[model samples]
Target: MQPITPFFMFEGNAEEAMNFYLSIFEGASISHITRYGANEVGKEGSVQQAIFTLNGQTFMCIDSPIKHDFTFTPALSLYITCDTEEEIDRLYGALSIGGAVLMPINAYPFTQKFAWFNDQFGVSWQLNLPGKGEGF
Candidate 1:
Protein backbone atom coordinates (compact mmCIF):
# COMPACT_ATOMS: atom_id res chain seq x y z
CA MET A 1 0.00 0.00 0.00
CA GLN A 2 1.13 3.55 -0.63
CA PRO A 3 2.21 5.13 2.63
CA ILE A 4 0.64 8.46 1.70
CA THR A 5 -2.57 8.12 -0.25
CA PRO A 6 -5.45 10.53 -0.77
CA PHE A 7 -8.76 9.96 0.93
CA PHE A 8 -11.67 12.00 -0.40
CA MET A 9 -14.74 12.84 1.64
CA PHE A 10 -17.69 13.29 -0.63
CA GLU A 11 -21.09 14.85 0.04
CA GLY A 12 -23.05 11.69 -0.64
CA ASN A 13 -21.51 11.43 -4.06
CA ALA A 14 -18.62 9.07 -3.48
CA GLU A 15 -19.74 6.45 -5.96
CA GLU A 16 -20.45 8.96 -8.72
CA ALA A 17 -17.14 10.75 -8.22
CA MET A 18 -15.20 7.50 -8.18
CA ASN A 19 -16.83 6.42 -11.43
CA PHE A 20 -15.99 9.77 -12.98
CA TYR A 21 -12.36 9.41 -11.99
CA LEU A 22 -12.14 5.83 -13.20
CA SER A 23 -13.53 6.80 -16.60
CA ILE A 24 -10.85 9.44 -17.06
CA PHE A 25 -7.72 7.66 -15.85
CA GLU A 26 -6.55 4.69 -17.83
CA GLY A 27 -6.19 1.39 -15.93
CA ALA A 28 -8.44 2.68 -13.16
CA SER A 29 -10.55 0.21 -11.22
CA ILE A 30 -12.98 0.41 -8.28
CA SER A 31 -13.37 -2.24 -5.60
CA HIS A 32 -16.78 -3.48 -4.68
CA ILE A 33 -18.48 -0.77 -2.63
CA THR A 34 -19.05 -1.30 1.07
CA ARG A 35 -22.28 0.35 2.15
CA TYR A 36 -22.53 1.97 5.56
CA GLY A 37 -25.49 -0.05 6.71
CA ALA A 38 -23.65 -3.26 5.89
CA ASN A 39 -21.27 -2.42 8.73
CA GLU A 40 -24.18 -1.53 11.03
CA VAL A 41 -22.73 1.88 11.65
CA GLY A 42 -24.75 4.22 9.45
CA LYS A 43 -28.26 4.98 8.28
CA GLU A 44 -29.69 2.33 6.01
CA GLY A 45 -28.85 2.64 2.28
CA SER A 46 -26.13 5.16 2.91
CA VAL A 47 -22.81 4.68 1.13
CA GLN A 48 -19.93 4.07 3.52
CA GLN A 49 -16.76 3.88 1.50
CA ALA A 50 -15.00 2.57 -1.54
CA ILE A 51 -11.46 2.07 -2.76
CA PHE A 52 -10.28 3.12 -6.19
CA THR A 53 -7.02 2.53 -8.00
CA LEU A 54 -5.63 4.59 -10.85
CA ASN A 55 -2.43 3.82 -12.67
CA GLY A 56 -1.43 1.52 -9.78
CA GLN A 57 -2.00 4.19 -7.10
CA THR A 58 -4.70 3.68 -4.51
CA PHE A 59 -7.17 6.33 -3.34
CA MET A 60 -9.96 5.82 -0.88
CA CYS A 61 -13.19 7.81 -0.78
CA ILE A 62 -16.22 7.89 1.45
CA ASP A 63 -19.50 9.70 1.89
CA SER A 64 -19.24 12.37 4.51
CA PRO A 65 -21.91 12.55 7.16
CA ILE A 66 -24.70 14.93 6.23
CA LYS A 67 -24.10 17.02 9.32
CA HIS A 68 -20.39 17.39 8.83
CA ASP A 69 -18.66 20.32 7.14
CA PHE A 70 -16.25 18.67 4.73
CA THR A 71 -15.07 20.91 1.97
CA PHE A 72 -12.20 20.41 -0.47
CA THR A 73 -9.54 23.08 -0.47
CA PRO A 74 -6.68 24.21 -2.71
CA ALA A 75 -4.17 23.28 -0.02
CA LEU A 76 -4.89 19.64 -0.79
CA SER A 77 -4.14 19.16 -4.47
CA LEU A 78 -3.29 15.98 -6.33
CA TYR A 79 -0.33 16.07 -8.65
CA ILE A 80 -0.41 13.79 -11.67
CA THR A 81 2.80 13.20 -13.62
CA CYS A 82 2.24 12.28 -17.23
CA ASP A 83 4.68 10.76 -19.70
CA THR A 84 3.29 12.42 -22.81
CA GLU A 85 1.29 15.38 -24.00
CA GLU A 86 -1.59 13.16 -25.02
CA GLU A 87 -1.98 11.80 -21.54
CA ILE A 88 -1.86 15.26 -20.06
CA ASP A 89 -4.46 16.54 -22.47
CA ARG A 90 -6.76 13.62 -21.81
CA LEU A 91 -6.61 14.02 -18.07
CA TYR A 92 -6.83 17.79 -18.12
CA GLY A 93 -9.93 17.77 -20.26
CA ALA A 94 -11.68 15.10 -18.25
CA LEU A 95 -10.93 16.70 -14.90
CA SER A 96 -11.97 20.17 -16.02
CA ILE A 97 -15.61 19.34 -16.55
CA GLY A 98 -18.06 21.31 -14.38
CA GLY A 99 -15.02 22.74 -12.64
CA ALA A 100 -12.97 25.90 -12.63
CA VAL A 101 -9.56 26.09 -14.27
CA LEU A 102 -6.96 27.83 -12.17
CA MET A 103 -4.46 27.71 -15.04
CA PRO A 104 -5.23 26.86 -18.60
CA ILE A 105 -3.34 23.94 -20.10
CA ASN A 106 -0.17 25.16 -21.77
CA ALA A 107 3.55 24.66 -22.17
CA TYR A 108 5.55 25.80 -19.20
CA PRO A 109 9.20 26.67 -18.57
CA PHE A 110 9.62 23.72 -16.20
CA THR A 111 7.65 21.16 -18.19
CA GLN A 112 6.86 20.15 -21.73
CA LYS A 113 3.21 20.57 -20.82
CA PHE A 114 1.29 21.50 -17.71
CA ALA A 115 -2.11 22.51 -16.33
CA TRP A 116 -3.81 23.11 -13.00
CA PHE A 117 -7.48 22.91 -12.21
CA ASN A 118 -10.10 21.86 -9.69
CA ASP A 119 -12.55 19.18 -10.68
CA GLN A 120 -16.32 19.30 -10.31
CA PHE A 121 -15.99 17.52 -7.02
CA GLY A 122 -13.78 20.38 -5.77
CA VAL A 123 -10.58 18.36 -5.92
CA SER A 124 -7.58 20.27 -7.20
CA TRP A 125 -4.99 18.66 -9.46
CA GLN A 126 -1.80 19.63 -11.22
CA LEU A 127 -0.98 17.74 -14.40
CA ASN A 128 2.64 17.78 -15.55
CA LEU A 129 4.56 16.34 -18.49
CA PRO A 130 8.32 15.97 -18.39
CA GLY A 131 10.23 18.57 -20.34
CA LYS A 132 13.67 18.81 -21.97
CA GLY A 133 15.52 19.53 -18.73
CA GLU A 134 13.65 16.95 -16.69
CA GLY A 135 14.20 13.20 -16.66
CA PHE A 136 11.09 11.07 -16.90
Candidate 2:
Protein backbone atom coordinates (compact mmCIF):
# COMPACT_ATOMS: atom_id res chain seq x y z
CA MET A 1 0.00 0.00 0.00
CA GLN A 2 1.15 3.54 -0.68
CA PRO A 3 1.99 5.58 2.37
CA ILE A 4 0.21 8.59 0.98
CA THR A 5 -2.95 8.34 -1.12
CA PRO A 6 -5.34 10.96 -2.45
CA PHE A 7 -8.87 10.64 -1.21
CA PHE A 8 -11.85 12.19 -2.91
CA MET A 9 -15.37 12.78 -1.60
CA PHE A 10 -17.73 12.86 -4.51
CA GLU A 11 -21.32 14.02 -4.71
CA GLY A 12 -22.58 10.57 -5.56
CA ASN A 13 -20.37 10.21 -8.67
CA ALA A 14 -17.42 8.30 -7.30
CA GLU A 15 -17.86 5.32 -9.61
CA GLU A 16 -18.47 7.46 -12.66
CA ALA A 17 -15.41 9.56 -11.88
CA MET A 18 -13.29 6.46 -11.40
CA ASN A 19 -14.45 5.05 -14.72
CA PHE A 20 -13.69 8.32 -16.46
CA TYR A 21 -10.19 8.35 -15.02
CA LEU A 22 -9.60 4.72 -16.02
CA SER A 23 -10.62 5.53 -19.58
CA ILE A 24 -8.10 8.37 -19.77
CA PHE A 25 -5.02 6.60 -18.48
CA GLU A 26 -3.42 3.66 -20.25
CA GLY A 27 -2.72 1.40 -17.23
CA ALA A 28 -5.56 2.48 -14.98
CA SER A 29 -7.88 0.06 -13.16
CA ILE A 30 -10.29 -0.07 -10.28
CA SER A 31 -8.67 -2.47 -7.86
CA HIS A 32 -11.69 -2.62 -5.60
CA ILE A 33 -15.01 -0.94 -4.91
CA THR A 34 -17.35 -1.46 -1.99
CA ARG A 35 -20.80 -0.22 -2.79
CA TYR A 36 -23.33 0.93 -0.20
CA GLY A 37 -25.51 -1.99 0.84
CA ALA A 38 -29.13 -1.91 1.92
CA ASN A 39 -30.04 0.71 4.58
CA GLU A 40 -26.82 2.64 4.09
CA VAL A 41 -26.96 6.42 4.19
CA GLY A 42 -26.10 6.66 0.51
CA LYS A 43 -28.01 5.00 -2.29
CA GLU A 44 -27.73 1.22 -2.10
CA GLY A 45 -25.77 0.99 -5.38
CA SER A 46 -23.61 4.05 -4.81
CA VAL A 47 -19.94 3.78 -4.03
CA GLN A 48 -19.09 3.58 -0.37
CA GLN A 49 -15.45 3.60 -1.30
CA ALA A 50 -13.17 2.59 -4.15
CA ILE A 51 -9.49 1.93 -4.71
CA PHE A 52 -8.04 2.59 -8.13
CA THR A 53 -4.81 3.10 -9.99
CA LEU A 54 -3.95 5.60 -12.69
CA ASN A 55 -0.57 5.42 -14.37
CA GLY A 56 0.53 3.16 -11.52
CA GLN A 57 -0.40 5.50 -8.66
CA THR A 58 -3.11 4.43 -6.27
CA PHE A 59 -6.02 6.66 -5.23
CA MET A 60 -9.18 6.28 -3.23
CA CYS A 61 -12.57 7.96 -3.14
CA ILE A 62 -16.11 7.67 -1.83
CA ASP A 63 -19.59 8.91 -2.60
CA SER A 64 -20.60 11.33 0.13
CA PRO A 65 -23.96 10.60 1.69
CA ILE A 66 -24.25 14.28 2.41
CA LYS A 67 -23.61 16.97 -0.18
CA HIS A 68 -20.86 19.50 0.24
CA ASP A 69 -20.51 22.88 -1.41
CA PHE A 70 -16.91 22.30 -2.41
CA THR A 71 -15.41 20.03 -5.02
CA PHE A 72 -11.87 19.55 -6.28
CA THR A 73 -9.66 22.55 -6.79
CA PRO A 74 -6.48 23.36 -8.70
CA ALA A 75 -4.83 24.15 -5.36
CA LEU A 76 -3.88 20.46 -5.43
CA SER A 77 -3.53 18.39 -8.58
CA LEU A 78 -2.34 15.04 -9.87
CA TYR A 79 0.99 15.68 -11.50
CA ILE A 80 1.71 13.12 -14.20
CA THR A 81 5.12 12.69 -15.74
CA CYS A 82 4.89 11.53 -19.33
CA ASP A 83 7.48 9.85 -21.54
CA THR A 84 6.37 11.15 -24.92
CA GLU A 85 4.74 14.20 -26.39
CA GLU A 86 1.97 11.98 -27.72
CA GLU A 87 1.16 10.83 -24.22
CA ILE A 88 1.04 14.38 -22.93
CA ASP A 89 -1.14 15.53 -25.80
CA ARG A 90 -3.48 12.61 -25.44
CA LEU A 91 -3.83 13.30 -21.74
CA TYR A 92 -4.34 17.00 -22.32
CA GLY A 93 -7.06 16.41 -24.88
CA ALA A 94 -8.90 13.95 -22.71
CA LEU A 95 -8.66 15.94 -19.50
CA SER A 96 -9.51 19.26 -21.10
CA ILE A 97 -12.88 18.13 -22.39
CA GLY A 98 -15.75 19.77 -20.48
CA GLY A 99 -13.31 21.31 -18.00
CA ALA A 100 -11.18 24.40 -17.56
CA VAL A 101 -7.59 24.61 -18.79
CA LEU A 102 -5.27 26.33 -16.37
CA MET A 103 -2.42 26.20 -18.87
CA PRO A 104 -2.41 25.22 -22.52
CA ILE A 105 -0.24 22.37 -23.74
CA ASN A 106 2.97 23.93 -25.00
CA ALA A 107 6.72 24.03 -24.77
CA TYR A 108 8.08 25.43 -21.54
CA PRO A 109 11.56 26.21 -20.24
CA PHE A 110 11.45 23.25 -17.86
CA THR A 111 9.83 20.75 -20.23
CA GLN A 112 9.40 20.21 -23.93
CA LYS A 113 5.70 19.58 -23.46
CA PHE A 114 3.25 20.33 -20.68
CA ALA A 115 -0.38 20.98 -19.83
CA TRP A 116 -2.56 21.70 -16.81
CA PHE A 117 -6.26 21.18 -16.71
CA ASN A 118 -9.19 20.09 -14.61
CA ASP A 119 -11.21 17.11 -15.82
CA GLN A 120 -14.98 17.03 -16.03
CA PHE A 121 -15.09 15.88 -12.42
CA GLY A 122 -13.07 18.96 -11.39
CA VAL A 123 -9.94 17.01 -10.61
CA SER A 124 -6.90 19.02 -11.58
CA TRP A 125 -3.99 17.43 -13.42
CA GLN A 126 -0.64 18.50 -14.69
CA LEU A 127 0.98 16.53 -17.50
CA ASN A 128 4.67 17.13 -18.05
CA LEU A 129 7.27 15.64 -20.38
CA PRO A 130 10.63 15.61 -18.70
CA GLY A 131 13.66 17.26 -20.25
CA LYS A 132 15.89 14.92 -22.22
CA GLY A 133 18.35 12.93 -20.09
CA GLU A 134 16.09 13.50 -17.08
CA GLY A 135 13.77 11.07 -15.32
CA PHE A 136 10.08 11.26 -16.13
Cα lDDT of model 1 overall? Answer: 0.83
TM-score of each: 0.86, 0.90
Pairs in clash, predicted candidate 2: none
lDDT of 2 at 76: 98
> Which residue ranges in model 2 land beyond 4 Å of their true spot?
133-136
Model 2 lowest lDDT segment of ten: 127-136
lDDT tens readout by residue for model 1, 6-114: 8888877888899999998778998657887654656556568888898888889888666576588877788888888888888898899999888889987777788
* Candidate with the greatest lDDT versus the true structure: 2
**Best-performing candidate as measured by TM-score:** 2
